[model samples]
Target: MKKIITLFAVVVGLFAFSSCTTTDDNFQEDFDTYPYAFEIKNVDLGRVADNEYNLRSTFQFEINDNLRDDETVLIYRLTSTINSNTPVWQLIPRTIYFNNGDLVDYFFDFSKVDFFITARANFNLLNRREYIDDQTFRIVLIPSDLAATMDTNNYLEVMNTLKLSENQVKKVKL
Candidate 1:
């Protein structure tokens, strides 16, 4: 009876350890880093106070969410097909680092957008009754680890065509 009981205990311990061991199948899921995320707080466009020379409106992007890792944030100005008559807002690279603390603020000066688009928009507003071209933009947070290995060209090529995960897509409209 003693021998049988000792053997049973040993068998149970072995099974427990084996179940917890890291294996190839579960390695990725267990050890992969969590994706970075950003919750855009205030998405508003208005004039900057105390700056008379700056006639163009200021677009303020306030992100109040905490991130797990430093990420390269991609901001894109959607094409006309996606958001009709909207000006191409931006095409630039901005990185959000962990050291930025609980909140990060990024600003885009609308004054830099193409003159033609702004001119046409202003003209339409004056000529056509309450004609304002509503625009939408997209922000994608790419984790540094995945971004380092990503095929950027391919990703940009299929940006609109492919279905991106909800966790990665953030939208701001004007």
Candidate 2:
């Protein structure tokens, strides 16, 4: 009885380990076997105050091919919200090209006079496949009427309090 139980346990362990293994055979049918991924990092926003702000974001992406066959473009938009539950207003739309190397810097300005700001990056690969990689940051711009009451620390505090919602991670491929 002991021998039988030991053999059964061994068999189960082997089966479990085998089941955990993955291979290309289990890959999705539409999976693009690209050997690289676009990585976005070091996203920073600086407050210029007086209804003006400076935006700077940097990213490094791997390029598997140099023939320009694989095109990776970054699409970004600025969003603001008066209330958390309502729709975010899209303030600006910009596109950056990435086809030559592994790094790209995206910079722009926001003078819409809004208190809240969020940026979303939509990466389009090969002009067909799409992935959503977004980052959100807070911008504290002093209202023209209240410039006298503005404190630089207030902007820093707002930035530190900014959080990325789960909706930001949800990818919508086009």
Alpha-carbon runs more than 4 Å astray in model 2 = 1-44, 47-52, 60-74, 82-91, 94-174
RMSD of 1: 13.5
Model 2, residue 65: C-alpha shift (Å): 6.8
lDDT of 1 at 149: 59
Question: lDDT of all predictions, in order shown?
Answer: 0.35, 0.32
Question: lDDT tens string, model 1, 43-155?
Answer: 33232321111113223333323233354545443324435533333432222223423221233322222111111221212232211223334544454455555554343
Query: Candidate 2, clashing residue pairs?
Result: none
Error of 1 at 169 (Å): 3.9
> How would you encode candidate 2's per-residue C-alpha lDDT over 15-57 as one tens digit per residue?
9766644333222111122211122223433434322234443
How many residue pairs in model 1 have overlapping backbones? 0
